[model samples]
Target: MEKTTNLQETVHSPKDEGGTTLGLSLDKAWAPKTEEKAETEAGNDSTGDAPEENHDYVTGYKLALLLASVTTFFFLQMLDMSIISTAIPQITSDFHSLPDIGWYSGAYQLTSATLQPLTGRFYTRVRAKWVFLFFFFIFEVGSLICAVSKSSVMFIIGRAVAGLGGSGLQNGGLTVIAGAVPLESRPFYMAFMMAFGQLGLIVGPLIGGVFTQYVTWRWCFYINLPLGGVAGLFLALLHAPDQIKKPQVSFSLLRKVIPQLDLLGFAIFAPCAVMFLLALQFGSSDYPWNSSTVIGLFVGAGVAFPIFLYWEHRQGAEAMIPLSMVRQRYVWVSSIQFASLTTSVFVGGQFFPIYFQSVKGVGPTLSGVYMLPGILSGLLFVLISGSLATKVGYLLPWALFAGAGTAVSAGLISTWGPDTSTAKWVGYQILYGVRGCGLQAGVITLQNVLPPAQGALGIAFLIFCQNISTAVFSVVGNTIFTQSLVKQITALAPSVSPAAALAAGGSAEAVRALAPPGSPELAGVIQAFANSFDTVCYLLIAAASLSFVASWGFGWIDVRKKPEPGKGDV
Candidate 1:
């Protein structure tokens, strides 16, 4: 409950401006005072206790400007994650490296998921406003690197760097809100922030397509420069109280802080995650399932995961994923549900463009346009879920709805063939959007149910799970799509080499160029691509089903009312 910063020593007295001070400490700041002091403070008009409670409740012009920055960064970060999907084809063609497509997407999420929890720790143990700005700058730098990269390896490196920075923006947005706004109004603010992000998520592919088809795929990364600059400016102008204690820069302090970061846990986890995903991506394509390379990766991941868990358990409070937090029902369930549902979203987003371009014979720009049905519907449902959660005080219905609805929609999507009508595709997307809407409601529910002290940790853990799932599932989808396309095409077109079809880049244009337009092999190529897409959709269904089972564990906690003082908010 100690003050995060020495406000009395570092800042001017609050008496000069309406007699208030920043309520900027963690859970301790909200702790109840002794009975005598509480009674005395209540009676003393000069102590300014009432005004202190309202000090950090940002409002009017300042609130608007702050939200503008948060929304911009949210959009940019989400956009960065998805924009690469449409650009991948052109990127692969340019580099002449089709086999490395999984790295292009998975690399970003790899660093993002692994670094997210550590960033949460940084926000808690440092001057968070500065940390937020630092992360944004890093993101901007990464975009610039991506825009100018000359090779696939360079671009993949840029993506990993960008993810390291992006890990902070979305999570930092929530942290800023928790610090500046009271608990009662958080859901509305969270909804507004997420709506902006959803807009980015939906528009990302379209932007990437336009850039790739009309100009160059590099523009997708170039667009981030000016937008990020504007967001950075707004954030710089805002003066906010520190949310946590700032560590003084010194070798001694650095030594202490390093251990608190649980570097050992991260060391174990990074390898574990990489090996697990590498094994899945390599199996059946680059290597046989039982090949030494694939088996070695699996064995490494299996060993690393347990070691990571053991290290984290031993680290106690400093653990990347603290054992205490994971044990809580609301925390673990929310993490699992968010991870599973979002994996479906990531898998669909990754492959939907291929479906449109390869099966439907659409150009990149038009393929992005075709994806609008799913993205727009998903955005609409996100806002609706937030509104419903705010009004109903319960999130269980939305979770249940998301799980079952996504499963059904995924099954429907899997049934789509080369001859399927546009209406059916559009309808299937709308059905899947139901799951998208429920995502943020689960976040709101998590924030509401956990104590304020635990909020940062919970949010970080959820982000980590979501990102890691996205990374793993993107690779899983990519491997499945590539392997299926090769197998199916080889079956129907014995004259077409599997390598040639794959190298043509998973689209109709590539297939058409490889086979004569009237040849039976052209039809088979398209069918193979469609079948590959269907595999991703089937995986989506399984992920959604697992999410449904996880949602049931959320129980019936209502978050509408504020918790009483001294209770741990749950």
Candidate 2:
């Protein structure tokens, strides 16, 4: 009865100061007329509208629970993404599918990137609680499938499925956070969620290492089940604010909502994304850079991109990329900056462990441990930046800090040699961590600059950029590393077959066994690995430097100040 009352109130509420109630702005065709009728018959105001006020119904203890639920899944999804890096070797060894390794991470990222903006529409049109819950379950099912996979094909399929769900988790969390909190206090909460959420990135490799070494690699996927269940349970029990809106489900409503999903734009963009990523994944690795297959994929992506843009323009508000929103300076700039930053991070996530294993000759567990200095330092700055943003009311400083820090640290890492000291490597990582993590603060600035209606879509678009860039660059990083290593191995260790070194699947253990430990040939092989890593680090520096340049465009906005009635956009 109470649930029914809340729904009725939300259904009839006037647009609040933020534009609309978080979950309550469903189209008339999608809302339940019967509920409104019943509330009217019960002597409630037939208007059924919530009171006009700025009070946040989702505050106090409920908000805490909400944060916990959303952040938990956020952490788990990130952990799931990063953990697979360390376990890739075991997965390949078990399936004997070294050539297919790119697809494992690529599949997840592809689906996640493609589905992200669409999920934003889902949140806006439907109840965010159900949407979040649905995606969380999908993520769990994907994890289950991954855990039970017997072949590379099945595992990649599972990863793509998980990515589909994981796409919603972060965006959904941010969307919910946006709706539930007041504008002034949002930076702290956003920072808090992101800081702890990044702990997954830190612990991911560590946990993956332990599971891969002592237990089965499958445990990496299995671990999500219990944690996700807890998050799902909380979401199920907690309710959106009474003023929050939700879409009503029916066949007629489905017809309206389906088109609003802009499937045509997605159809165009999905192929574009797939083709481009496939080209990168295959070029100079699976196929010659000049191969017909590689050229065809690139050509297809290039052709499809303009068509996708045209389609999105036609769709207008229904579009995934929404040109209306994209035209805004802040939206596009933030998207590009976020894309570059995350691209570098994801590339680093994959290759850092490779450097530890192949170049430094450390095992998976130790490699994860070695990443802590950077991860911990990054987390500390994320927190500090968030707190400072909330207090100072500006966000550009954080972006500049992150961008400059990332560029410097990544540039330093490019100098790493086969025999670089532990102190140097650790120091470089700390430099990257301190500023790299400050990007979280930028989220507050971006979201704060837009009205609530636009903010959700903006956040989704930002996430889409991040994921798509990560997917594309991961392939680029792999291609560079593989090509460089093969070339260097041929030059440095002429007697060691380059193909054999490549086939060893980049396992330090397997590569070390090629010649006696401490022999000149073994040293050459290690040096080749280090030199290849240097190439990837240079790539990171370039991406990070671009991100720094992009940061300069975000005009300093005091996020804590409430925008005047008509001043949301820059």
Consecutive 10-residue window with the lowest summed lDDT within model 1: 5-14
| 1-570: candidate 2 lDDT, tens digit per residue | 112221222222223476743222222212255324322322212365532222355778998898888889889988997798788866766775555666788888888888887887776556567778888888899999999998888998999999898888888888777767766677888888888898899899999989988898899999999988888888788855412344454566556566667777788888898888888878846788899999999999999999998988776655676676676666778888888987777788788877888788777788889989988998898888888886776566778778888989998999998889989999999998966455675476556555444456678888998889888877778778877988999988878988777767655687797677888998998899899989999889888888889876666555664433454654
Shift in Å, residue 54, candidate 2 = 8.2
> Where does candidate 2 clash, by residue pair?
23-245, 24-244, 24-245
- For each candidate, the alpha-carbon lDDT, in order, equals 0.75, 0.76
Per-prediction CA RMSD (Å): 9.0, 7.9
Segments in model 1 whose C-alpha atoms lie over 4 Å from true places: 1-55, 241-256, 563-570
lDDT against true structure, model 1: 0.75
Residue range 265-303, candidate 1, lDDT tens digits: 888888888788778778834788999999999999999
